[model samples]
Target: MEAKLYDGPMIDAHQHFWQPQINPHPWLAPDVLIPFRYGDYSAIKREYLPPDYLKDATPKHNVVATVYVDAEWDPKDPMGETKYIHTVAEKYGMPNAVVAQAWLHADDVEAVLKAQSQYPLVRSVRHKPAGALSPAEAQSGIRTLMSDEKWRQGYALLAKFGLNFDLQTPWWNLHEAKRLALDFPDTLIILNHTGLPYDRSAEGLKEWHKAMSLLSDIPNIVVKISGIGLPDKKWDINDNRWIVQETVQIFGTDRAMFASNFPVDSLCGDLETIFTGFKEAVKDYSPEDQHKLFFANAKKYYKMKI
Candidate 1:
């Protein structure tokens, strides 16, 4: 019998806290005049900060703790996103965990890794999703960057820095991800959102599923079953359970885990609804597997000491 899952020993492997007003969030590309405003739910309202990150996110997901992902504090900034996250994670003593952005140009990789030297909570780095482009196209771009010799050199540095790479990309980018995995087998690589694609009517879902299966072939890469307010349709996590469950079928329990991608995902549902939806989505799995999806996997991936 499958045991019930009650938000087990959970450390939210993914969650963001940013405030355009109070904190640094310059990448919030808004569409105020659209059918509905999009990009960065934090823009619609102040989010990902003390009251929300500490008070709401903690209780809502039944989160025993959280891994603070870098909010991409503008790629152009000299300070870089790592320091910003380091400051906040240190300020709140959040989750005793953190994931900062390395966002290297595939060339300045060493400088990027060395930049985060002091921040102990800085556990990982996110290379933002090249979602708009197809995997092949992105591969061309990434390879162009990697072929620079210096870029290939960067991969070694990231692996050396003891950092994890959270690929915040879409389904189309999976192939390139696999390439990265082959090149750096020792580095922990995570796929955020089961590889988001243009999913309105399962148009590319079958293809995406195949891509995910291929991605799982790389032992070091894990999948994050989270993302929201993305194009193709569902409004909230509750409405999106089918897709999440489908993703689990492809990635399986050991390779996949739950993440709230909060504030960003807040565009769809509050933390309660998010957790409720996730619980519903995975409730049918075995207790041990369920534990891995909701918590254990994240603890291991990000090396969260929680």
Candidate 2:
């Protein structure tokens, strides 16, 4: 018998792609990488594409399609991998909505949006945080370059673009992050990697809950149940009980969505393993709720055509 995919569009809204051999970019430090602890990061192989996806992940887990989030630098200009992924997604007719990076510097964001409009799936914005865990290329300088007035100006530009803001910082910054989301209620903010909570110690865990709870109240903020592959044994992708449960309690299915967060997450488990963990956590949830976590909510959040 032929396998049947998920009934509705099983859209994995958050996944990435990069060829280390071809790209040779150290997106993150290998020392701090979670995949290295689980197994050799090099053993995982170089770059991940759809074929790698099929080999590693099972269809029964139900991923009808995916939306590609930008995985590389936004180019010195706005149009680097933007054109490449668009070509790939368009060829297979993948739903393939992309979260393009737009530095929030001054009125230049308007130029970023104009560049985004060139592609159909360029539906959102992600500015690589200036000083996250890595220190490689200079960031867009949009966020820091913009003063309060500049930020206020850039915020309106993002809204005018009808773009969602993808926040890709360590979850520890939730306090400051909360303010950013609340300040821009009009811009739908998707928190990446569950805000990357650094909840290893008792205090870290305690603070994580409090910070997350505060952010939950912000109506514009939604949490992504993705990128749980921490090198730290405590927060490994296979062990996502606390992150999953806490997220459900704080954001609920209505404001939360599950993501493959693959290739990057491929650093942890295969796509199927990630989905197995995802479905297992939410299995007790009602079908309606589970549907929301897996598919519906992402569609609604990103305004996806599916």
Candidate 3:
């Protein structure tokens, strides 16, 4: 059955806007080529400000508001990204919320968290915690895992500042995530990219499913169902439907949200293709549940003032 298009207001739970020319994003630098999920991201290395994003989203989707996730800005000046986003929001009237950057284990973590909390638009912070490369490597336990005392020391500070954490680790490290959530029950942990289920093999999916199920048992954690695109493939519904549906099934409608992960995700497909695929994937659900998945959950999770 073809899913009807949703015309309701949406709060993009996760997306980014960057001006690499003005503010330095090392990853987006001309010389720096990091291993990316979407292969050659050269197509998106240019300045993608609010106007660029709205051109891709508006008229196609009713995008009432958006939450700006931090693009890796120059770490030497962590607060620079948040300040720039505030200016964009003031000028553009979108990105009603901001997920600023913070290095959880950095020497200046405490000062950074305190400063980030001061911004009215800042609601959450993302510090992609260090994790193992593969399940085999994870078995021995990496020192920088969320379990690390120094990292936990920094993570524990989130509650004090009334901030949430946006976690972007692979599915294999969710066991570590579960423990972190249990220990710090007060801090709301928003899992990015559906726990990053990149490996699509039968065995890979089984592992991903097991990891997702394990993490779902924790009440403090929620998930954003975005960034499921593969390197060399187009963003087709057939390839991503199961991952989206299974995530909502595991985390429940209230705990899972749909996001664009745009500019970066644009490397795979257009915004219309991604959001339409999301609407179609869960069209079997009731309207209320659909609304929660696409809109309400994001607003609530990010404390978006929409």
Candidate with the greatest TM-score versus the true structure: 3
Worst 10 residues of 2 by lDDT: 134-143
Give the per-residue lDDT of model 1 (tens digit) for 22-47: 55555554432234224434344554
Off by over 4 Å in 3: 1-3
Error of 2 at 77 (Å): 3.0
Candidate 1 pairs with clashing backbones: 17-48
Q: Candidate 2 has what TM-score? A: 0.82
TM-score of each: 0.83, 0.82, 0.97
Quote the positional error of residue 256 for candidate 3 in Å.
Answer: 0.4
Q: What is the lDDT of residue 291 in candidate 1?
A: 86
Higher-ranked by lDDT: 2 or 3: 3
Candidate 3 per-residue lDDT over residues 1-306, each given as its tens digit:
445656688888889988777778989988778988788888888888888888998797988899999999998898988898999999999789999999888889999999999998999999988769887888786634497888889999999999999999998899888999999999999999998998999999999999999977788999999999988888999999999999999999889999999889999999989998998898888878889988899988888877
Ranked by lDDT, top first: 3, 2, 1
Better of 1 and 3 by lDDT: 3
The count of backbone overlaps in candidate 1 is: 1
lDDT (Cα) of model 2: 0.68
Q: By TM-score, how accurate is candidate 1? A: 0.83
Q: Per-residue lDDT for 25-127 in model 2, tens only? A: 4443344344332355554446667666655555566576677787655356557768767766766565458888676764577887777866778788887
